[model samples]
Target: MNMAISSTPTSFSKSLKPSLPKARVFNLLKTPPNSHLRYTLNLKPPPPRLLFRIGNPKSKSQFKSHHSPIRSLFTGIVEEIGKVKQLGSDDDGGFTMTIHAKTVLEDVNLGDSISINGTCLTVTHFDTQLFEFTVGLSPETLRKTSLIELQMGSLVNLERALKPSTRMGGHFVQGHVDGTGEIVSTEPEGDSLWVKVKTTPELLKYIVPKGFIAVDGTSLTVVKVFDEEECFNFMLVAYTQQNVVIPLKKVGQKVNLEVDILGKYVERLLNNGVVNAIK
Candidate 1:
């Protein structure tokens, strides 16, 4: 009887004996080795950062394939000597002045090319309290230059236009103002400033004394040409009279000459090699 009782009770033999193996839920789904959940469940999502930006559109077709969309020709050098500080009246009577310049802001833009006293303008807008340009002057360039007799401030002389690979310097200036000259006197001549100018007896057989002249548009070096039967003076010296001033020049005042289209192509190839060496 005692043996029979042992076979059953004792909490049914401690609930069938084998307890500790309860941790096998497939070994708790097996991952733990160098853990990070087995490299985050075997990851695969990371590859995208080629950024370049600037007006971005994939670097705008590689910036339009290293740029050559052409359009680039500029020339400006008169640095300071600007006045006519306001001449309004636009919306079609055409005239929107405003130049109070001082070296025309050194590298001014907004459609560059200024050339005020010698005509050729463009600026159209600026800052630092002034720059605005626009000149529809025709009553024959407002009766042949003085920019309609300036005066609000006056003093002018600016230039900008010449990039065809530059270096031609004092010549090919197509800032195209053509005719207008008077300042027949300046004379100081030491710190330099001889000047004279006069022009238009048909630009007098292209002046020439030491040649190369531009006058109100600067580039001087004629030192003396004379030829008066009615006009073609020249003189010019240079070292800076505020880049050429004498009350912005007087003795009748007016300046802007450009003779030297390579001295009219070396005088038409020496008059066509002297008419082909007299045939």
Candidate 2:
């Protein structure tokens, strides 16, 4: 089945300045910056206070009216790191999955965004303890990533859809794994290791020096880039604990890769005629 998604722009009204209490005003005047007491004594009384009316705070209803719900965001913990209970194809040629997650229902809702490994899937059903979600992988998504190789007890990271107020801690990620890359080599560099991975040519343009990239849902920065006849190779330098789990990555091990979303948008603008050109 084809998935159709849409997004709406968000807006905010100007915030009204709150009236300062008398104590606070006196404290400000006492500060060193306002030590010119003689000059202030000559000044006339403050102008008639104009009472600024403060409107009610924006509510979820207001947000819903102005924005699309599918674009909402959430983040959840990996409770039990449950395995793939079952996987099979449905009548419509779509894939069905029964993931038995422990503590999934503790905080997860019906439409939460759960990042299984690096791929985001939506919650379809749940009880008080566990929940089930489904991901309909396309032929291209299946061919490009290691989702098919997921076993019964694979550890996966989970995150809910993002809210407008949420601080973007990681680079913008769509939870869409673009392609699978093989680990080339890893060398210890002080407390960190410089990891090299072989990536596709199309993904190479976004892999810039010091640019951000996500491997298996973990955001990492690119340190260097190299090109060969077989593939474009790049090294990611990360700290010990952060780089260890993924560095043991075998020479030919396939890893889910998600290029920085911001990079992709910038590329689109450069190609579409928004900016004069990207320098």
Candidate 3:
């Protein structure tokens, strides 16, 4: 499988600063044991946060972010599946998209961020009565991600940004897709499924047996790694098989792949001599 990277300054995210990499995939892929849904054991409703404000606050619920909501974390636990309702080109070299969803729209406001597949997108327009929302996609985002593969009626995994009180059963997922890869194969082992994905060597370097990876936004653990083949595999149990869109995909399909962020951070530190300075 061919894996490509784009360092283009534009972003698919309307909210992220130009520095954040363009989103690479939306058919993005993740599993349960590695899922952070378990971390949300704190069932208490999160204390009200100091909502970021805009020109004038109509209400606390109308808050918006002036920049990327990077402070927010995603635990790679999918909440629901959404379908693309409308898609078309915008004059600004981007696209306008409206998706049909319920769970992610419950309290969604003008600037709220929702991870479509594994890419975080801000809500630009929405309608509670219709259960749909619209967001803008930059051209770089389309060049880099599988979202370009999306069409009306395509299913996408949906996840909301984590609140102090939200449940976290998966691992910390940055929702910044590294790139796209092909689902090379799939096998079923009774009540579970074993799937293999082939990506580039640069991405495969961070994947290890038992390490965490977010596929299309579902947090899952790596079951095996095949360095020579530039691929890896993971299993989805009966429960996850039904909850996510991964199991439903076929061989040769493209899925979003976000290797754990920790590895990249460490690499950056090592390269910049931050680790050496600390030592």
Q: Number of the top candidate by lDDT?
A: 3
The list of candidate 2 runs beyond 4 A from truth reads 1-82, 100-105, 127-136, 189-191, 229-249, 277-279
lDDT of each: 0.47, 0.49, 0.69
Better of 2 and 3 by TM-score: 3
In the predicted model 1, the residue pairs found to clash are 75-160, 75-161, 80-103
lDDT of 1 at 56: 28
For residues 105-220, write the lDDT of model 1, one tens digit per residue: 66676665566654565565567544433332322333344454454566677655555665654544444545566665566645554556566566767777776666556655
RMSD of each: 34.8, 24.9, 13.9
The worst-scoring run of ten residues by lDDT in candidate 2 lies at 8-17
Whole-model lDDT, model 1: 0.47
lDDT of 2 by residue, 1-279 (tens): 222211100100001012333232222112233222223223333222212211223211211111123354332222234456555433332334456665544677665665565666656545554455444333233344555444444445545556688777666666677666667676775665666777777887678777777676666667777755334334444532342235544555556777776788888897898897544
In model 1, how large is the Cα lDDT of residue 277?
87
